[model samples]
Target: MTLVRDIREDDAQDWRRLWAGYNDFYEASVPTEVTEYTWRRLLDPTSSLIGRIAEIDARVVGFSVSVLHDSSWTSSPICYLEDLFVDPSLRSGGVGRALIQDLVDLGRARGWSRLYWHTQANNQRARRLYDAFVEADDFVRYRLTL
Candidate 1:
């Protein structure tokens, strides 16, 4: 059985391992400083970031990180699922689905206005999982890096 739960202080090492795998899969080379900062933010109570981990028989196998923020379009907060990854070996084993379902349950309980996320157009594997929840909107995303 897969168990999903909020991230804890002791999960740093396991989280880092999964995090590294996540970055590797995306071919992203996030700097060490930024990675450390993100870990700290996830553990900070006052931060808007929320982190959850998935464990199968006590071994961490996946994780999801989301951000909560007030939205101008709605009276309630919105949840943006920033990062989600399952161990490559454990893909298709229900961990990914469980993590997203956990977020959906959390959003419903918290009265979030919406929950959304995005991925590269070529990420068919992830798109398949995401599409199971909702159809993709016809929205284009642009970024400006300073």
Candidate 2:
């Protein structure tokens, strides 16, 4: 069974390994400083961001990051599942599902109006799991990189 728990100060080393795997899967080279900043943000009590890690047999195998913000459509805040990643070697062992399910439970506890996330259209593996949970809406995302 996978244990899903909040990120801790001592989790940096293991979390970095999973973080690197996530970046590798996306073919992006994020700088170490950015990761350090993100780690700090995740631990900041005032920050809206939340992070959770999945471990099996005491080894970290996956992680999820999320945020809650006010929604225009409802008074309750909406949750954005910013990132989800599991070690490729352990992909099919329910780590990802456990991480997401934990986030969903957390979001509901916090009174979030909705919980959502975005991913590359080509990420078929992830899409398959997501598809089993919710129907895709007819919405497209656009962005301008600063």
Candidate 3:
């Protein structure tokens, strides 16, 4: 059986391990400072960023980070699933689906107008699952780093 729960301070070891894997999957080099700050933000009750962990057989196997933001087009907030990752060994075992669905349920209960996320174009494995649950849009995303 699998359990999805909010992240706790004691989850550092597990979270760092899974988070490192997640960063590697995206070929991202996340600095330690950023990771520490993110950890603090996730645990801060007033922060809009939240995190959850998925455990199976008492071992943490995956995690997700989401942010709630106000939307100009609607009164309800928008939920953006900023990050999602599962252990490579645990793929296709319903962990990913469970994490996403948990957030979907949360969004529904919180009156969020939308729950969305973005993944690398080549992340076919995750895209497949996301495609199944959410509609695809033709919008293109561009970012400018300062």
Candidate 4:
């Protein structure tokens, strides 16, 4: 069975491996400095970023990061799934699904109004899995780099 739990200090190497795979899947590259900063933030209790790693037989094979944010539309908070990654070899083995379910449970426990995420339109496989939960939003996303 796959076990899911909060990311621990000793899992840095495995986290980096999965993080590299995640970046490769999106064809994006993050600087080592930025990655180190993020790693530190995730482990910091004061940081808003919360991460969970999935382990199968004590080896980390997947991870997810989520953040809780205040929403004007509701008095309670909403949970945004910032990043989720499962080793390519472990895809379709319920690791991703379990991570997502864990996030949902967390949101429910915290009284979050919504749990949402976005994926590239070209990611048909992920879309297929996501579709089983909720339909895509009609709005488009735009980013402005500072």
lDDT of 1 at 46: 96
**lDDT by residue (tens digit), candidate 1, 25-124:** 9999999999999999999989999999999999999999999999889999999999999999999889999999999999999899899999999999
Model 4: lowest-lDDT 10 consecutive positions: 101-110
Sort the predicted structures by TM-score, highest score first. 1, 3, 4, 2
TM-scores, all models, native as reference: 0.98, 0.96, 0.97, 0.96
TM-score leader: 1
Clashing pairs in 3: none
lDDT of 2 by residue, 1-146 (tens): 99999999889999989899899989999998999999999888889888899999999889998987887899998889999999899887788889888978887887778989888998888988888668778899999999
Off by over 4 Å in 4: none
Candidate 4 to native Cα RMSD, angstroms: 0.9
Comparing 2 and 3 on TM-score, the stronger one: 3
Write down the TM-score for model 3.
0.97
| Candidate 3 Cα RMSD (Å) | 0.8
Best by lDDT: 1
Candidate 4 or 2, higher lDDT? 4
Better of 1 and 2 by TM-score: 1
